[model samples]
Target chain A: MRKTQPYAFIMPSLLLTLALGVYPILWALRYMFYDYPGYGSATYVGLDNFARLMRDAEYWNSVKNTFIYAGGKLVLTLPLSLILAVILNKAFRGRQLLRAIYFLPTIISASVMSIVFFIIFNAYNGMANQFLMKYHLISSPINWLGADYAMLTTILIAVWGGVGNYMLLFLAGLQGIPNDLYEAASLDGANAAQKLFKITIPMLGPVLQMIVMYAITVALKGYESIMVFTGGGPYGKTDVMYLYVFKQFFPISADTASMQRFGYGSAVGFASAIIVGVVTALYFYFSRKMDKIY
Target chain B: MTSAKILTLVPRTILWLFLLLTAFLMLFPVALTVLGSFKTNLEVTVGATILPKVWQFGNYSTAWKAANFSRFTWNSTFVSAATTVGTLLVTTMAAYAVDRANFFGKRFYVVLQASMLFISIGAVVLRPQFDMMIGLGLQKSLWGVIIILISAHASIFFMLIGFFRGIPRDLDEAALIDGCNFYSVFWRIVLPLLRPALAVCGLFVFRGAWNEYILPLVFTMTRPELQTLTVGLAGLRYSIGSASETQLMLAGACLSILPMLVVYIFANKSFMQVSAGAVKG
Candidate 1:
């Protein structure tokens, strides 16, 4: 009874993980080599999918755009969140309220928030343009969602939505740093910048590494807001890897002529996963090497 | 002394000013959405004002009807509640067994879950996942989504295991010595002690299920009636024809945010602590 009891308890979750989590991945791997449209039997066209993937311009374009989007978001978000964390970590009035307010965006649905941003950044009369024109910040409203600025606009929204969560993480990292280090630095006549650069950031190394790793994976994976905002439009300027994978699987609009190419999509999906994996592995490798230097 | 005073005060004042400016930026969009929800569609489109000329509380009702929000709300609540309950049940049971008994393949199971947590396949496998649901004859039901959400419980399992280890085995042993079976020991004894851990995990699971977009979006594509609030709200983007229905969309956005806001208000402390705990784990 005791021996069988353990299996009884663990079986439900294990089986669930296997069926939903593991099975789909294996299914995708198998489908990668086939040429199955959703309705037909999959035909094994060995190495054809890989060869097509190599020649696919759109897939590689999305890969380039993914790096740009992720890179732009991280560049802006990390420093902004760090600064906010340092400020909020101080002893001040309404500190908790401030932290909560910043963290508020993180809780809201990304799609819903992006819709609101869509309104705010509307080309004609969006509050962003209105306010800017009202203040004479610009003579005319710029088309924020145009091809010239769509990626930039998306990055700004991403930063706005993401900064708070990372700030909270940074705040947690800040809290772990002992105060005596700052006090000792003060005894040596260290100024605010010196103390921050020399002591606080060094102490935050481990937490920072973890948060960066987390942020990288999330930024790469995130396409919810973009999907709602642009539908990978304006000549597919803002198309990321996952969004492209999604479009391949399910056409957003009825007019899509070449939708539901399951076999090729599975191949694309596999390639996307490998790219993400390789990037993650490279991050781990580089971060480890930096650890040795430090 | 006067020059020194000016130097110290200057930076401090600038710092406070900058912080307040950031706070304003953070609150602006949400404030605009809420206020816009009450304005007329023409007023919203004009962007000529900050406040509504006359508060149109009727927009909420209009939005509700137009978006089929009542059904979506129910669907969201049902899925989130069921996912949380199911996840808590299976994860807790698994955590207990793994923490207590030395079962065969136990190490392998733990390692598998850990690797699953690290190796995310993202949206790549959505096709196969949908196909698997069709295979199970559950492609038309919300149960497919609930099951998938519950299965992605690697983090929750690890969290519960950590919580489980902190709980002394002496209590379980005492219950067992009292002629209680393993199930009873779990049900009557340890389950009661796991309330704190359960609450945190429950909140997280509920929030994830509630705010989830992609899975529900894909699964409910064929059955529009099964769409959760997030999916339904996103569908409202252009569904009301060429006019865009900005006011209605704002009203719906506000409505979708309410349940999550209520949860956040009630458990504000736990929410902050969870973010902090994430890094440590």
Candidate 2:
């Protein structure tokens, strides 16, 4: 009776998972092999979708864009967040206020943030370009949303919105460290540089790993900002894989020629899923290995 | 001693400087947006000014009307509240069962939870789920979106359960000895002890539902009246064409964020504690 009662308690969640989670994945898998419009008659086209994805130029472009975006975010945001975390970890007046201010963006809606950034980075009347020209930092306002700078601008916005949350994560990790370790290092006459190198970084390994994994996952799934700010515009310069998949399903252009190939889009979705899955798996493997060592 | 002190001071100073610069960069967009919200359209287009020459308080009222802010706010509140309460109830019961019960498929449950964590957003699976919902006659409904939110958040609920397991079993035993049944013991004893975890879990579920975009965007397509704050904001941003209208849109954006800002300010300390507890556990 005791055991059976527990099963009853868990049954609701299990049923929900089956209904909403497991069944959906299975349905997608089934649909992948079929020639189905989003809302039309379906026919099996076994392997045709997969075969076309192998040679799709747009799909490959999306793959390249995903890598660049993810790489850019990891390189720019991670180090900056780490540095900020270290500084905020120190004793200072008004540190909490600063921390709250820094973390403000994380709590806001991404779509809203994207809109705010779009206005600030607007080509003709943006504050960024106006400030630059006012100070003679530029001869004229650079077109930040143009093809030449769109992806980089998108990256900057992403990093700015992201750094605060990661900083807080790292701050929490830093707080968990024993103060006595720092005292002991000070007794040994270690300079701040030595203390950071010898003690702080090593102690923060687990937190760093967690942050990196999160950053990579978020970067790989980067879509909302692109969707709102650039709409993968200016010759598809900012088009990442997720946006490409979204476009394939809901093409903005009304021309039949420009209409998305849902069959091919599913293939793209599957491929992106595979890439993210592999990366996440590798992250877990490495983290687990490191855990054993530590 | 003097050389060592100098070297230590230099690195600390440099680190502080670097942090201050980064913090400025991070805070700039938010600060600028707030400034933009208060500016007239003409001032907004003219240049970057720290303070608006003409502060337009009416823009807030205009934005609220333009976006149909009341409808979106109500929809978001209802959906988010439902999700939070449903998730807490379902997750706590499920977690209790997984942790305390001697079940036959416990390992399977564990694997399911772990896989849910690692799987990406399951975007590929979205259409089929939509199809299934359509087949079941649930397309373009608020309830459909609520159900999706609950399902999507199950993994986090399981994580909270894992945290709950860290609490000792002796508490449960003592409660049982006081003549409480499993449900009573869970409600009276275990559930009360899980407040911190529940708060963190509730906040996550609330935030996720409140800020959710794509699912509601896709599922609630036919029903404009059913849109959440995120989709409403997206539409508002897209529709505003003129510079003045854009300034008005910024006001709308500020109005949308005002509730969350107020909540965060009031709950800042508890929010931090709950979030830290979730991660650390």
Docking class of 1: medium
Tens digits of per-residue lDDT, candidate 2, A137-238, equal 999889999989998999988888787778777888788778899999999988767887788777877766776787788789879777878887777788
Tens digits of per-residue lDDT for model 2, B1-281? 69999977988688668667766877777777788888888777765687888788877777767568778888889989999998888788888888877779988977886677666533566666676777877776788788777876555665677777778999889888888777887788888888887887787678778877777787766688998877787777655674556687677677667777788887766555554554465
- TM-score of every candidate's chain A: 0.95, 0.90
Candidate 1 chain B weakest lDDT stretch, 10 residues? B236-245
Error of 2 at B12 (Å): 4.8
Which ten residues in a row are the worst by lDDT in model 2 chain B? B270-279
TM-score, candidate 2, first chain: 0.90
Enumerate the candidates' DockQ scores in order: 0.70, 0.55
